[model samples]
Structures are given as structure tokens and as C-alpha cells.
Target: MTSHNPHGHALASHTLPGHDHHAAERARSVADHAAAVVELLRPLREMDRIETLPLSQALGRALVQDVAAPLSLPPFANSQMDGYAVRSGDLSDGGTHLRIMPPVPAGSSPQPLEPGAAAPIMTGAMIPAGADAVVPIEKAVPDHFLDPAKTTANTPASTAGNGNGATVRLPGTAAGTFVRSVGSDIAAGERALAAGTCLGPAQLGLLAALGLAEVTVFKAVTVLLVTTGDEVVEPGQPLPPGKIYDSNGTLLEAAMKQAGLLVRRAGISTDNPAELRALLRTEGQGADLVVTTGGVSKGAYEVVRQAMADQPVDFLHVAMQPGGPQGLGTFDGVPFLGFPGNPVSCLVSFEMFLRPALTELLGAPARRLPLRARLSLGEPGGQLTSPGHKHQVRRGSLQPDGTVRLEGGESSHLMHALAGSNVLVHIPAGVTELADGNEVEVWML
Candidate 1:
């Protein structure tokens, strides 16, 4: 039967038959529940389209297409040293001292070396023809020369010259020493950066080396955040009785920023159905996703549930402690996730469920931040027990040698414990007690 309330709203006591049996049957393992949620949201997920962006703006973006070398790197056969540039056939015992021709500096056109002659070429100068190797000035004696009659007055005679316009050279100094062959680093039309690669500093440098001014990359996700609670007060505000400073807003915002999402909005909302509805329906426009915390449970003043009552929402009790109540739905065509109000619960819920799903949909690497470590302290036989329906998350520290020391209490509202924690220990359902030194799976925050 349906009854009309004071506001003429129809209310029906929709109860499941055999409530105890339903509760027993509805409970599931953590893995099974997570898999079910993922499958449910898979159809609604979509990655953004690719766009071409300049190298300066492409940081933290995923590559959309393979980057091929436009031209061969080090496009020409150039000298790698500051000595001389010569072909590799002119070496002889008691090195042949040929009259030095005009010098070839860098950025000059390539000129063929005269037969049996050498040119004084600077480093990075294109190798000339005829001569085969370079003889560093340090190894060559500047003195041997032809007869004095053959010396021209224009020749600035070397101080070591014997007045015959000749220069002495040492043997074995003309071996293959400093020449970088063309295409030594990369060849033309070769794939330098593969498709689906995430562009970082090194990747950008490689693209720049290949002369790419711009590249194609996937668009980044934009998110909106709505923090909810009537007992919450903003930081720097004087806290009144029965009120506490809001921590979830700041913590969740920072976490989203660290995950590379552009957080468009983050603010606290009271338990007012009308105000919450307006924010959800209007404030989240143009956002790919909307996240909220609190008011999703069966409480007397749970405004979020009241606001979204007629909306398409799938409310479920996930098999995870401190973050059991979860709400997944689409509002105004944007995916919305409502997390538990507790600060630690909000963060843990994001890491365990939402983060992995979003990363997969955005073509990002999945969050596999698990660490294996031995428990350092023993727990009383009855202390570590949890209901069979939920996975309990506990705060812990991973010691230097891969041992885990449990930190503060496991309550979802304990922000101090969360602040001191570096890892979240995941105790699966049905595991009542674990002794010290047992291996546990942890997610490093």
C-alpha cells in the first residue's frame, strides 16, 4: 500500500520478502562484488578523443599515434672531435705531411679534399673527400717541410717548421677516432615513440630530437567534487559544538589532483535535499565525473538519498569495511560516485574501486600498488574479526625490511590514523584472525 505524505509525495514500504534470507543471499565476497560493479559500469565508460598538442603542453598526456622519425638524426656524417675532418685512407708510417688546404669550419658546404691532401677542419665539420683520417695537432710535430724554395711568403710558417713550409706528424694518430656516422642515433621513417605511450620528460626530449613540434595525445578527464555533511565546518572557521572541521574535502581534492584529474569543484553541502539536488544537477555540467561524500546511508536526514531518490542510482553495500556503503549512478549524463562520509573511508573507497575503474577507462595504467609484507605484531585471537560480508581495511606502516606494523585504530572516522598511515592493509572477507608474521596485501597510498 502507498500513502501520501504531508507534501503529497507517495511513500511505499517496499520491503524484500524473507529479509533475513535476502540479506544472507545478497552478501558476496569482495572480489565478486568488485567484479560485478566493474561489469555494470563498463558500458557507460568512454575515453576522450585524441588531439594534437604542442610539445610544451603534452606533458602527462597519453600518445594517440606512433611518432615516426621525420628525418635521420645527426643528418650528416660529422666530426665528433675538435681536431680535423678527413677521409679514412691517408694514414702512412711516419705520417705524410701534406700542405694544409683552406680550413672547413662547421655550417660550410661540403668540399672534396684534394687527392693526397688534408684540410684543417674543426669539430662537427662535414668530412671531406680524399683524406681518410684525422691527425690531432697534439700528436703532430709542426716542423717538417718541403725545400725553402717551395715555401710561399703568404704561409705563416709554423714555429716548429724548418723554414721549408713543412710540418712533422706522428704515426698511428690517424686511426678512426671521432666521426659520428649519419643516422647513428635514429633513421628516417623509423618508429621512435610507439602509440599508446605516456609522454614524460624523456619522451618529450626524444620527440624534440626527432624535430616534432607537436604530437597527438588523449584528452584529460575533468572531475567535479561535492562534499556533504551538516556537521562539517570549513577550516579556519571556529568550530561550534557538535561540529568538526571538514577534512574529506581537502583530502579528496588533493588525491584527485595527484591522480592527474582536473578537479573543477570542491565544496561542502549540508543535508538539504533541495540544495543537494540543485548542485548535482547544475554544478556538474561539462564534467566527465562527479564525486560526493556522505548522506547515502539509511539515516533519518540522509539528504543525498532523498535528493537522488527518483534518479537512476544503484545503491549497494560493498564487501569492504570503512567504505561499505556506495552509490553509483548517472546524473545529467555524468557518472557520479557517492562515497562514505568518513575521511579515511572516502580515500580508501576511491583507491579500491573508483580509481582502478577510471584509470582503465581512460587508457591509463591500472593502479597496482600492492605491497607484500610480514605482520610485525601479533593480534589477540578475537581482535581481528570482521563480518563475513566486508573486507576490513587497516592502517599500517611498511618497515624498511618489508615488515608491516599496524598503526592506529581501524575506525573510519579516525583521520589521525589515516594521516600517519603509508599503506592500507586489505583483509579479505571470511578471514577472522591473522597471527603475527602472516603475509598481507597492502595498497601503498
Candidate 2:
């Protein structure tokens, strides 16, 4: 039977033998379904699921606890420049000549500066205890450091001054100049990173600097992806009449992987309830969640709904465009989500339901970036209308001038348009008509 919906689209229904009419009639709001998904996946964030991984493998994983610094950065007082280390009092008489002592290269310790004497200290070299200031080599008379072998230790400033002498002229400067004090960058025992921080390159670098070879992070959730439909075939196979390639498998798998979830494809299952039930029981053994695409609608060949009718699952319609049919519940003791078959609908369902739920529950994948931009009609005098009772998600390109222009018509099968879009423009459930320059919420892809 077919009936016209409020939006003037034909709503087709088919009653298959042994179908549960109550499941097909069930409905839910998008927010309610989202919350249910979060609740179902909450166990993945439990403490027992956390893992201790090496720093090299911890990138993009959420840190489960605070990482305290083991030691202060730099660890010691050092020179910030390659210059002369001297006591400020030695140059008290305006500019005075000082005997050049041995040079202090980086990583080498040096003795305290003698009275009225200076030492050539290289950058990052430990500063002697008595030296309180450093004057760059360019500020000195010769503007160059003498070889440490040629310079004598503890050469006095008054010894035989003049050309080729051990003494050199120096300028007056303040104390504590060009010195890198200990704990300047980060103090010891300080919190380097707090809990729930997504470890990235800079965070991992800090962990390495803190002498941490490994870190504790939340374990990635394992998802069993099952794309159902007898008409669905692999991409490499020869196309049979009235059959289509299985895009939901690749599309959803990539999306889940990008969100840091380990995905295992169960291949394609025909519209046989007995076969799908056996497949789920087998493949969902160790999976944290089971996600299926297609067969959740009110059609006679809805394989997922037919197979899961006796299980604890709900087949419902959400107040949304292009992707309204949804399935959420437990199957074979694993959390399950059934998405629409259309490629764009499957992706949108993941983004709207699973992605946010993961962020809220697991804290691994970061939330999508949201922005508000003026809506730009693609053509002159073009107007867009959204169902007042359903939230509309449209593909759009966020322009440099802060306007979001529609990429294609509001259709779920437009894969090319989805690829070209940089953002998903949101029209709220209460909104109906929108003109150019109207502000709309957009989520960055």
C-alpha cells in the first residue's frame, strides 16, 4: 500500500509474512535515539577497557589519567646564548678589561669564574656558580671567542694587558642576563596533560620529554559492521540486473575507523532472517557493537528488522529528512544500530547519532566543529523549505566570505554533492522556510 506523506512524498509499505507490525509502527525523535545510543555504548568507556599503550601507538587515543612531569624541563641552569659568563661587579668601572678563562661548551661543567675574570660559555652549557651574567660575543671588543686551549685557566685581568694579551675588554650589563633558569618551561611534578585529552603529536612529544615511554588510554571500541540486502554486491563483481554495489560497508567502515573504532566487516547478508541471525551470533562474539545498514525501513524485504524482530531492537522513524528510518537495540548480546541503505543516509545517521555519542561517552574522537553562517541560495530567487517537524541536514560549501551555499538538492543519494560539501548546514525541526542571508548552523566535515 502507498499513501502520501505530509511532504507530498509517497510512503510505501509492504507487509511480509510473520512481520511484527508493532516494530514497524514504532517511532522516535532524533534526540531520544541519540541519547539511547549513548546509553548503549557507555560500557565501552569503563575503566576495565582502558589500555596501556606505547607512546608511538597512543596517538589519537584519549588519555585516561593526568600525566605528571617526572622532572623539570632543561633540568639545570644553562646559558641562553654563546657569550662570555662573568660577574656583573667585574665590569663595575664602566667598561673594564677581564682575563679570558677556559670556554664552557654545552654538556660540559666548568669551575666558578675567578674574581675580575670571564669565561666563554656556549649556548645550553651549564653556567658556573659564581657567574651571574652573560655578554654576547658580538658586544665584546674582539667579537669572537678565543680557543679554550689557547686561553689559560684563572687568567687574572691585571696580567700583562695589550695586543695578543690574555685580557679582553668587556661592557657593563645587569646580573642574570641571558640565563635560562631551571624549571622555566615546566616545573617537576606538574600536570603535563589532564585526563580525556586526545593525544596528538605535541602531547606525545611532551610525554617523551617527560621520560614517559608509554601512556594509558581508553581502548578503541571494536565494531562489527554488517551490510544487509540481497541486491547488494561487492564492487569488483559483475553487476547483475537490478543490483547495486555495497557502498554502506566501505562508507561506514571508513567513518568508524576515522573515529578511532576498530571495524570488522561481516560481508553482505541476504534477506534471509535465519542466515542473518546465525551470522550476527557468529561475527558479534567479541565486538563491542554491531552496526548494520539497510533493512530497517517498513518494506517487506527489510532483512535486519525481520531477523531482529524477536531480539531487543526497535525499528523506528526519526523526524529527519532523507534518513528517517533507524534501528537501535541489543542483538546477540551486543549493541546494534541499523542505518538506512542510501550512502548519504548511512553517513548522516553515523554523524548524527554514533559520532556524537562516542564523543560524549568515550572522549576519543573530538566533536565536529560547529559554526553559524548566512545561508546562500545557489541560484537567484531560489528558496529552500524544510519540514517543520524534522531536522534537515543539507550539504553545503562554506565560503570564504562567511556564507554557506547549498551544494545540491536535499536528496540523500547525492554522493557527489556530499563529497564536494565542506559542511552540513542544519535547519532545525521548527524551521520551515529559509531565504538567502538567513543564519544557519553548520558542522564542519
Per-residue lDDT tens digits for candidate 1, residues 1-445, read 1111222111234653433435535645557656655664564333445678999998867676788899887787777765544544655665655555566789886678865455666677877755456666555555232344544544555522344443334345444567667788889999888776667789899899888899887776677889888899999999999999888889988888877678876578888988988887677878877888888776687777788888787766676777777787877666778888878888988887766764555444336588898877755332444445457888888899998887776667778878887998878766756777778999888
Q: In model 2, how large is the Cα lDDT of residue 235? A: 92
Candidate 2 clashing pairs? none
Q: What is the lDDT of residue 334 in candidate 2?
A: 84
> TM-scores across all candidates?
0.69, 0.82
Error of 1 at 436 (Å): 5.3
Please report the candidate that would top TM-score against the real structure: 2
What's the C-alpha lDDT at position 173 in model 1? 47
Looking at model 1, report the run of 10 residues with the lowest lDDT sum. Answer: 1-10
For candidate 1, the TM-score is 0.69
TM-score of 2: 0.82
Candidate 2 — what's its lDDT? 0.84
